[model samples]
Target: MSLTSAPGPGWLLFSFGMGLVSGSKCPHTCLCQTPEVICTGKQLAAYPPDIPLNTRRLYLDNNRITYLPAMNLGLLSDLVYLDCQNNLIREVMDYTFVGVFKLIYLDLSSNNLTLISPYSFSVLSNLVQLNISNNPHLSSLHKYTFANTSSLRYLDLRNTGLQILDHAAFHHLITLKTLYLSGNPWNCNCSLLDFSIYLIVSHLDQPGEGLTGS
Candidate 1:
């Protein structure tokens, strides 16, 4: 008898084949698979693409994404790494990073962002390294932007096009050791003289490399 004559078995086989084909054609906007989660260069303009539930690493680089959705990112609970570089993101809305508590490293460089909202990174307590460099238009950071990020050690703000820093910009970052501000246009005037004095006194008390001017 021909395979088609076995109706029950043949129907089962056809359904299985269709499922396999569908699984093979995963959408270009997301890679919902094992081992690695690669979503780079997707050109996505929408928020929350269909990421895998078990995803550990996420790469959302080289897209046209301009804003993060207001909904909390609590679904990707297993995520450990995230890369959102080279996008057109201009502003980070409040509470935009909720539930991403396990992230260790974050890169938000090369974007059109002009400001970091106060308390923007407060909930990322486990974050160890952060890179926000090369954003030439970023000129200001709210006083409490890094207030609760106690575990942050390395902060990169190089070439950020800053002309002034408020006295409390780096407040509460007591654990911070290496700060990269090499290329910012820091204005060292009377308004900043107190902060400069504090740094000098603190540096002399600890006897380390001292501060420099523009």
Candidate 2:
């Protein structure tokens, strides 16, 4: 007489195989794992390696990345903190961060970025802290670059090489509490008075006494 064995769960095996494949397909240059959640500046020229789905914090500082990858970042819904400071990023494409709904803190400082596209922070509704300081080449910011980012409380623009600030630069930043604008060669002319007044009335910072040309 011959005996037959019981059948196993095919769906579970299929899912496990798929997960392994996904993990294998992740970029080889960077460390990608669900159990370990950390990725620092790895000299990545293209998009970052596929991160584990459960990753909560990411450290991507000091890279040469110029743009965000084409992959859908919305899948990393659990990401609550991110650091992309000190990169060569120049421009942030529209909808670059469409799916990062849980991000509460972000650092984009020390990059080669020149201008922030209008509505750049529109999708970052939960961002409470942001840093864009140390970008010496950044000359201008779009009028609505920070529009709809009501949760942002801290903004740092120290040493950004800023010469002029438009009238509506900080228009909708109602929740801003601490702003740093030192180390810049601010014109301190009539055009900057509007920004100076706004900073004073908002209790962000005090102007340095009289105007330079006065």
Candidate 3:
């Protein structure tokens, strides 16, 4: 049986954004509020430029955006919530989110992602929830892909088409809970031995708790 659990960047150029966002109105015809930017369904093809440094929440869902260029959102130091679901993103490059260390919630579901660089999210120290579900083309996760999100609590990987997980894939996720791994075709063999052993040792296999394939 496959394992399932539920329970569950860079600075610089940032100095320049501080000036552009100080008193700027929303750029690219997007909505702007005190600490949130609403750009959902605007049909944007790229990450909005000149975001306010004080923004705490950003919504970029249901758009045609294909790439999240490095430093695209790195200037928003105060950012804590981000939503980029249903886009055309094909890959997650390293340091793509360099300086938003305070981000606590993020969603990248329903994209066309095929690969995510290891350590892509190594800087998120306060992250608690993340969703990358529905990316059917993303079949593998390099070890250390989630290197530093020790505070993560909820993770949703539903419908991701993943077949195996590295035993050490989650070795550093000491606080993880509410893991959703349904809708995957897991190969239950020696490849899963370590992951399965981890589940048992972590108490994530306490009967009726994991792997409900779709």
Candidate 4:
């Protein structure tokens, strides 16, 4: 099925080696520049197939996408940014981002996702920012969830209904610069004592009063 509905604009840029071009194919109900394709609020049910191959930025927020098949988004291998927040996505399967090796920013917030396969982000070696906040159903983050994202600098897990944080969940994120854990019903008792201590010792700063339910 076609993944386009109408055209709209948002602020983001995606430039490649050849510089910006004109007349590049843009999905119906979308706007395309040499490096960016914006299609927000299109009520899209699936990914658009007609977007230019060289696109570096893509916006598909406020849609009805429920699942992201592995490598389906790999078509945009050069993508550096993606925004799919406020959708119905329920799970992040393994290798879902394997092809987007250059992706630097990703936003999958406000979805229905309940599970995140540990290997789902293994291939995003260059990713710097990741947002998975507002997923009320996502309650736990496995210790190895971020084992491969050594370059990740920012992580957002706010309002995810998290009650338990695996002690080693943030172990591999040595380069993480900022983290968001507010709005979670964190049981700051014994279970989180070590994790909390680790955060303090590691100097990983949280936005504000990140954990609650002590």
Best by TM-score: 3
What is the alpha-carbon lDDT for the whole of candidate 1? Answer: 0.67
lDDT of 3 by residue, 30-53 (tens): 888979999999999998876777
Global Cα RMSD, each model: 13.6, 11.7, 6.9, 8.7
* Better by lDDT, candidate 3 or 1: 3
Stretches of model 4 off by over 4 angstroms after superposition: 1-24
Q: If scored against the real structure, what TM-score would every candidate get?
A: 0.75, 0.78, 0.86, 0.85
In order, candidate lDDTs are: 0.67, 0.68, 0.79, 0.79
TM-score, candidate number 2: 0.78
Worst 10 residues of 2 by lDDT: 1-10
lDDT of 2 by residue, 20-105 (tens): 55633455565656534445667866557556656667677877877764243444656778788988888775556655778888
Using TM-score as the yardstick, the better of models 2 and 4 is 4
User: TM-score of predicted model 1?
Assistant: 0.75
> Global lDDT for candidate 4?
0.79
The clash count for each model shown is: 0, 0, 8, 2
